[model samples]
Target: MQARVTGHVQGVGFRYATAQRARELGIVGYARNRDDGSVEVGMAGHDDDVANLIDWLQTGPSAARVDQVTSEEIAPQSWTDFQTG
Candidate 1:
């Protein structure tokens, strides 16, 4: 799944926290900061785990003031580990 998280999502450890959560859930993908101030996260894992991550994205880290999280199913990528960029 691919998710775009908006609102106060950058420069606040959002990507790092997301990578940590994804790792704990055995998810493999990446979390990157977009130029538009949103965070883009790509996750591939068990359906339940992916869903769990998406749910967490709604609130994100304590410093994040998440206003929206939009997601969509996508072709799974061959990622062996989760990363923050």
Candidate 2:
């Protein structure tokens, strides 16, 4: 799944926190800061895990003021581990 998380997502450790959460859920992918002040996440794993991650992305870390999270299914991609960039 790919998600574009909006609103106060930058500079709040959102990417790093996402990486941590993904690791906890055993999801594999990456999270990065977008130029548009959103955070983009690409996560792949069991269907349940992906869904869990998307749910988490809506609220993010304690400091994050997440306004929206838009996610969609995409063609499967391979990732050995979750990362932040």
Candidate 3:
């Protein structure tokens, strides 16, 4: 699934935390800080794993005070490894 998470998502190690979370879930994709103070993520995995990821986005890391998380299911992409970009 592709998630276009927004609000208080940058400058808080959100991208790094996302990378670790994605790895823990055995997901393959990329996450990056968008220009508009939001973070974007693309991930591919089992339904449950994806769900768990989506759920975590709500709380984020200790430094992130996530105001919202928007997610949409998209066709999977080919990524060698999850990363921050």
Candidate 4:
């Protein structure tokens, strides 16, 4: 699924942390900081791993102060591996 996570998500290493966790879980996708003070993530993996990621993101990196999370199921896309954009 593709998730567009918002709120206090940038400049806090959120993307890197997400990439590491996703990679460890054997998930494939990419994450990037948006111009709108949000983080956009594209992940393709088992439901459990993706759910875990969504939950973990509620309280993101030490520097992050996540205030909200919104997820949506979308057509899955293939990625070579997890990465940060």
Candidate 5:
């Protein structure tokens, strides 16, 4: 799945926390900061695990003030590990 999270998502350790959670859930993908001040995340894993990650992205790290999350199912990518950039 691909997700774009909005609101106070930048400079608050959101990407790092996302990577950590993804790793814990055995999800493989990436989290990146967008020029629009949103965080974009791509995840691929067990259906349940991916859902869990998406749920977590709603609130994100304590520092994140998530206002909106938009997601969609996408073609799966070949990612070996979760990362942030």
Candidate 6:
């Protein structure tokens, strides 16, 4: 799944937390901050894991006040591990 998390996602450890969560779930992907102050997360894994990650993106870390989480199904991409940027 490809997701764009909005609101107070940036500057709040969202990306790093996401990477940690993904790794724990054995997911492969990447999370990065956009210029518009949103966090972009791209992940590939089991259907349930993807859904769980999307749900987590809505709340983010304790410091993040997530306003929105928009996501869509996309073609799967291969990755060795999850990362944050």
Every model's TM-score: 0.98, 0.97, 0.94, 0.92, 0.98, 0.95
C-alpha RMSD (angstroms) for model 5: 0.5
lDDT digits (tens) for residues 6-72 of candidate 5: 9999999999999999999999999999999999999999999999999999999998999999999
Q: Count backbone overlaps in model 4.
A: 0
Q: Given candidate 1, what's the lDDT at residue 58?
A: 99
lDDT of 4 by residue, 1-85 (tens): 8777777788889999999888888889999888889998889888899998888878878898888788888886768899898
TM-score of 1: 0.98
Greater lDDT among 1 and 3 belongs to: 1
Which window of ten consecutive residues has the lowest lDDT sum in model 5?
Answer: 75-84
Residue 32 of model 3 has an lDDT of: 91
Q: Name the regions of candidate 4 deviating beyond 4 angstroms.
A: none
Q: For model 4, what is the error of residue 3's alpha carbon versus the real structure, in angstroms, after optimal superposition?
A: 1.5
Pairs in steric clash, model 3:
none
Q: Select the stronger candidate by TM-score from 2 and 4.
A: 2
lDDT of 6: 0.91
Alpha-carbon error at 16 in model 5, in Å? 0.3
Better of 3 and 5 by TM-score: 5
The local lDDT score (0 to 100) that residue 65 gets in candidate 2 is 99
> Each candidate's root-mean-square deviation in Å?
0.5, 0.6, 0.9, 1.0, 0.5, 0.7
Model 2 worst lDDT run, 10 consecutive residues: 70-79
> TM-score ranking from best to worst?
5, 1, 2, 6, 3, 4
Best by lDDT: 5
Model 3 agreement with the true structure over 11-79: per-residue lDDT tens digits: 999999999998999988999998899999999988899899989988889988888889988876888
Model 4 compared with the native: what TM-score? Answer: 0.92
Q: What is the C-alpha local distance difference test score of each model?
A: 0.96, 0.94, 0.89, 0.86, 0.97, 0.91
Q: How many steric overlaps are in each model, in order? A: 0, 0, 0, 0, 0, 0
Better of 3 and 5 by lDDT: 5
